[model samples]
Target: MPSRGSATTAVSGLVALAIAVGVVAMLSIGVGSRFIPPDSVLSALFSPGGGFYDNVIWELRIPRTVAGLVIGAALGLSGAVMQGLTRNPIADPGILGVHAGAAFGVVVAIYVFGLLDFRAHVGFAFAGAALVSAAVWLVGSRGRDGATPVKLALAGAAISAFIGSATSLVLYADSTAFDEFRFWSVGSLAGAKADLLLAAAPFLAGGALLAFGVIRGLNALSMGADVARSLGQRVRLVRGAAALAVVLLSGTAVAAVGPIGFVGLTVPHVARALAGPDHRRVLPYSALLGPLVLLGADIVGRVVAIPSEVQVGAITAAVGAPVFIWFVRRRTVREL
Candidate 1:
């Protein structure tokens, strides 16, 4: 159990993070190609007078911003849950082959099936991700010790490599698919549509709720599988629930915004550092920090080049890779 002072501090940090998310969301709406003033952005959002900037805000920026928020939260929570379940500090949706699976599914839909529409690809992405996640789990759990953190990580890495190679081969063979998937592969919120975001809402919300429900189980698991089982935790059930949550959250996000990496890989560690080892606090902090990091990355992508924008995925990679290296080198990041 966390001390009262620690709990209070965590609560306070969450509140501060909530405010920061709000501010960054506003920036996401206001700071874009045209640079709408903050006052105008507010007016366009609240008043709804049907002006040009108002239309831009309502039609374009709002949807993207909302997508960013949802996707960020999903990735963050997914990362946190994955790390907890695998007992690996480095476990992430993208690292675990989920993103590669989603990407491959979308490519197959476009190349083989001729399904060009973004909305139509969502189901394929989810299916692919679910299958790959199951495969990773199966391989990881094969050993006598049963799905240790090191085994899970190694399994995920091998599977991800295989799927990635398959994805590349398919793309190399199909010009049309290559052209269509290149943009989506890089990942960005620029083309996010309101309908797509709306469609993804239920899955993201359900995943988040499911993740929160397993907080106690995750906390016990943190102490190790034997300890968790000894404490009356149903290890299989908890693992199943956590895996389902990861599939729902990670698959949907990949389907929506392509595979934005680093957010999942880095945000949970940041959350744990801030709020201590408690999953209850770590989950919420990750949710808040996820958007803060992603939206900030998105904003940077927008401003870095005046006419041409960098993809959010690229920005996250640039930022996250260094942090990942630092975490590995610091000797402070303990294996879960």
Candidate 2:
């Protein structure tokens, strides 16, 4: 049970994060190569069609902004769930082979089928993530113990390494893939389209729900599996469901936006610091904070490179790495 003061603080912090998300989102829409003034940006938002900056605002920036919000929230939730599930501070979908699977799928689509369409990449990448997720569960749950944290972690690491090597080999041989696929690999919101966002909405929503559903289980598990079991938590069920959420959330995000590594890795720590160790607070905080970080980095990416924008992924890494190092030095509060 949280004290009245702490609860009040959490609610205040959440409100602040929500405001920040909105401010950054507006910046994302307005502050691009050809900057639309705030008044015009607001006007365009109020009356979207046939505007002065219709092409840039509605077509390009809006889709990208929407993608950032959805993907950032998804990655944040997935990372929080992953860290709790594995009890590893650095864990994310990458630790579960889910990300490697998506990357491999994209690599195959480019190398094998010569498909360059971003839409096509989404389907292929999602399929790969699904397959790898199932494989990880099966391998992790081998024996009567059934998906212990150590077993799951080890399984994911091994599968990720294998898939990574295969992907590297393919990229090494195919120069066309090397050139074309590298763009997606680096992660960028420039590729986001309305169709892709529509396609991903269901998956993202489902993932968010699943992540929230297991928060109690995760909080229980944080006390150790034996203790969790003693407390009537269904350990295996929680682990499986959390892993599925990671696959749905991080998998789809990677498929959609390529791999923006730092959003998931770093956001949870910030959430924990702000919201404390309780996952009910941590997960929600992370979802908001994730988009705030990603979109802010994206806004920076837009400005720093005048005519040609830097990819959001690159900017996130550049920005997030320093913040993460600071967290490590400070030993700030963390969820896992």
Candidate 3:
């Protein structure tokens, strides 16, 4: 249990992050190629009459903003849960092969089913991610140690590589699919629709619930598996639930906006720094900070290149790669 002072600080951080998310989301709506004034953006948001800017705000910006919020939260929370479960500071949702699996599914859908619609790819992506996650768990759990962090990491890496190769082969064979996949692979919130966000809502909600459910167990596990076992925590069950949550959250996010990396890999660490090691606070902080970082990245992507836009993934990579390198080089990276 966290001290009262720490809990209060965590709550305060969450509130601050929520405000940041709101500000960035508004920026996402207001700052585009044709910059709508703040007053105009507010009026359009409040009064959805038949104006051109209103259409742009309500029809275009709102959905993408919503997607950014949802996907960012999913990635952030999933990443936190993943690190907790694995006892690895750098463990991300992709470490379970969920991203690669989802990408492969999208590729296959494009080539075999002739499904080019972004909304239609959700089911295939979820299915692929779920299957790959299960396979990784099975492989990792086979040894006497029973899904140790190292084993799970190794299994996930192997499976991700295999899926990546398969995806490349399919893309190489079909130029049309490659063309479509290339854009999706890069990742952006430019074309996200309200319906697509709605389509992925249930899975995201379920995953978040599962993630919250395992927080106590995660906190216990953080003390070491032996300590956790002594404390009567069901380590295996917690790990399994965390894995499922990761698949649902990561897969749905990838399906919505393709695989936007580093949000997961980096956001949790920031949350931990803000809220202390207690996952009770860390999860919510991550949820809030994820959108803050992602929406900020999206806004930067929009502003940095005039008429032409950079993909959100590209912007995030530009920022996150250096942070990742710093993390790796740290003398004592905090493992929580």
Quick one: ranking by lDDT, best first? 2, 1, 3
- TM-score for each model: 0.93, 0.96, 0.94
Q: lDDT of model 1 at residue 306?
A: 77
307-330, model 1: which lDDT tens digit per residue?
A: 888999999999889987898788
Candidate 1 steric clashes? 0
- Alpha carbon lDDT of each predicted model: 0.87, 0.89, 0.87
Candidate achieving higher TM-score, 1 or 3: 3
lDDT comparing candidate 3 with the true structure: 0.87
On residues 34-132, what C-alpha lDDT tens digit does candidate 2 reach at each position? 989998888888987777887788889899999999999998999999999988788878877888899889888999899987688889899889888
Assess the local accuracy of residue 209 in candidate 1 as a C-alpha lDDT between 0 and 100. Answer: 93
Write the candidate numbers in order of decreasing TM-score: 2, 3, 1
Question: What is the lDDT, from 0 to 100, of the residue 273 in candidate 2?
Answer: 76
Which residue pairs come into collision in candidate 2? none
